[model samples]
Target chain A: MKYKYWRRSRVIPFTLLLSNLVYVSFGLDPAASAPLVADTAFTKSAFYDQNEQCFRCHGNSKYTYFNPVSEKDVSATMCENRVIHRNEFYTANHRSFACVDCHAAEYDTFPHPGQLRMEAPYNCIDCHGYDEQYAQYHFEEIEEEFQQSTHYTANGDAFTCWKCHNPHTYRINIRNSTSMQQSIAYDNQICLNCHSDFERFQLLSDREEINLIQKHEWLPNQGLHFSQVRCIECHARLNDSLMVAHRIMPKDKSVKRCVECHSQNSLLMSSLYKFQAKESRSDAGFLNSIILNDAFVIGANRNIILNRISLIVFFASLGLMLMHLLLRMIFKRND
Target chain B: MTEKVYHYPLWIRLWHVFNALLCLVLIVTGISMQFSEPNRSLVPFDLAVSIHNSAAILLIINYLYFLIVNRLSGNRMHYKITEKGYVKMLITQFRYYTLGIFRGEKTPFPVSEVRKFNPLQQFAYIVILYWFFPLIIITGLGLFFPEMIITRIFGISGLFLTDLFHILSGFVVSMFMIVHIYFCTMGTRLTSLFKGMINGWVEIH
Candidate 1:
């Protein structure tokens, strides 16, 4: 029964591909020539029913395959994983956004325009174009930051924001401490999507493969560090902004030493630990504003009282001992 | 005329010289590291850390060697103050240092083959070897292994407290070194104890 189910499902996609190929060989439009074919999928409307309409085809658990990029076939499992989860959009930070805001403006038009391509519904730069005055708006400043990013520098035109954030499901400003950890892990997962997958990485870039474990062998509990801290914390250049910088450096240039994080003025405090506004002050009196936060750093969080008291006692004890020795020497000479 | 007696053993002399040099290196490097920053450091921070940790390891080995020698040669008994009249012995030693030494009065306890230290010297040595050294070493190990099980057991603040103890104990030891150097000069002839440390014999008046 399972074999029959698999055989039937496999034949449908191949048949569709053959028909498309036949039309393409004749130099005629494949789906455009036949209006009835595209009609079954999309219902014409003035407004978009984003949830049901988009997911109707995308959510299907079928073995539909396509080469989204050059010569590399993305499988059915990958497509379903990418698009099927509609519930995620509702919970996502971008929940209020309509599908058409990013997708084709009039995507519900009966037989979609001959000019429209299935791929690249909208480029990131299309919506997020630079605006000098309103630079603080979500898109403009991030676009500026992205331009400076190592990804953009390394891959030039090849890298896009979509490589890191899936527009359908990305979230932001996750402040709850417990969930913040998961949010950090989620963000890092996006980086690992390309980095951890050697095959996928090689398809896009010519850089050497990274062995994360070997790279971070000097650090103890490397897994814990990978999870707790974002990759950009060490990899990116530190900027005045609290967020991790976009300009990623090579591994050798990255801060891997133990003293970097465990010192009196740890850089982690400026980036990760600066969740609260008040904690950002570089000099807020005793022990600095960094250690005063809720977190306890091992070597960095020194007690001011203990340090001051110890110093006083150390000098007083030394002074008394010296005085006693001098007095005895003077008295001996007198006698 | 003064009588000469064999005091410091060959191993003791060697360990003493090595330990003195190691302690000097540790003190200098440790001070530089404490105030070190990227923009401002007495020595390069990495170099200071390397020297400090390496000297600490050597000091640990030298300390262990001294411990073994004390045990095998039964020199541990010299540092043991009897429970009875311990306070009186301290008082007498204190007076001898303050008044009696200047007046050329006889000491309550004199260095001998069996009794290597006076009561006050014995107490100070006991405190440094048994108490301070162990505290500093344990804290140093704690700094090295920040993520060890003890860190979890003691909570996050415990490690900072351990560092504080290490620093304080080191400060006390540095002060002890200053006093110890001066006392080393106080032997019957100024260089008598110094010569003894070098050649294993002290000329006692």
Candidate 2:
């Protein structure tokens, strides 16, 4: 009986050690290693600290002022001219970068020297010198076209890529079923931000008369159509490239004919409805991409071969009946 | 002189009337959809689709009624022709339409209880009912489930093939309707066959 009790006691220690080993192997102590992950992931360097310090004054709402009256008290307003909202800066596309990378400023000092005001704003061409980097999406073509656009022609260096995309908040394309609709709306928002803004348009352009509704008076249910299709589809020249055309033209150059969009070779077939190209573009396929696109438009989606065949059959049937009737009438007269 | 004989039954008359109406609706709506354009929508696209689909379902039901009734009543024999001298019978019927009818010659195969249709009609009816109707229904159903089963077919989108076959079959059926209607005028009196359909009896001479 004493030997049996001694054997059970020895077995209990072995089982306990084995269970502990199993627990350790299966990552039972997640909390103990969490700090190590956090330290490595968010390691703060001297430059990063300087960026954080700069945001302390410029980003904080309490320290930054917009109105001239608020700037009178130097103690109240740490950032006198510009106020970068804390949340906006943190969520910006360039949030990962240090301020010193874009701006030549003193990093060692606690209070930034007054000399920082003289520094020029960052140029986009500095980092994106090589065009080949954007070959996949052909963004270089857009850059080239932007120089020839109405904005560039009028504003010259005043309008840049950052004005539209706003690197501080821009993100990669959001791909979904509604991605095309969202993209069209997003792009239009940029144009409307200035064009629809009365004060801004007056300040920017020579022509003060700006009314989007008035411009599109010819289109029936203008509001609904505008919401559905992209503005660029008509305003710009249709191309195989993914980039939106910046070459804004006069009203005469825009797509005016109903057949333009209602035909098999419609611009929407290649661009907005491109997702359907694979399935609808078969040689034996009856419909093109535009017709297969969500709502079936009559003339737009019609197959050319089917149309010809139907017409031929219709006429042939009518002709055959006419000939038979004539022969029957002639035979009756002879009888 | 002609003797009055029972030709159509009540159920058959009802089926014929309903089938005719359904086919008319289907043809009109289908053609309107085919010719639809941005500026020229004969009927709204949604309404056209709804009407076409509703009529199709009803027509299918009507077809099943025909199949069930004809089979039960043993009236399906009217559509079948005996192999012996079938081709000769068909030629005689054709000649009656193309030549003999102009000279007011008697029909080669007159209407009877057992032989409801002439050889030519039996052949035509068999082709139209057995061949064309099935093709139209299959293609129409294929279009309804385009995403799942009808996307790709024979190196082309199945939707395309479906639409093509549907339109072509519809056109042929439409032509058949015209010819069928015209043949109704070929009876002894213009209104004689129509009266027979209404009263379920024909005055056979």
Top-TM-score structure, candidate number: 1
Tens digit per residue, CA lDDT, model 2, A209-292: 678999888664465457556676677665567534656555578877554564555566755565456334565535664445
* Per-structure clash totals for the candidates: 0, 3
lDDT of 1 by residue, A70-180 (tens): 667454443445454555554343344445444554546533475645334344444334533223334554666777777787787678776777765665432323344
lDDT of 2 by residue, B1-205 (tens): 6776787899999998998899999998887677665556666545677788899999889988998999899878777766699989889999988778777788888876566677887898898888898898888776664444444555454556677688788888887887777677656665788888788888674
Ten-residue region with minimum lDDT total, candidate 1 chain A: A32-41
Stretches of candidate 1 above 4 Å error?
A: A1-92, A95-139, A166-193, A212-230, A250-266, A280-286, A292-303, B98-104, B149-155, B203-205
TM-score of each: 0.72, 0.53
TM-score of 1: 0.72
Q: Could you give the DockQ of candidate 1? A: 0.16
lDDT of 1: 0.64
What clash pairs does model 2 have? A92-A168, A93-A168, A262-A300
Q: How close is candidate 2 to the true structure, as a TM-score?
A: 0.53
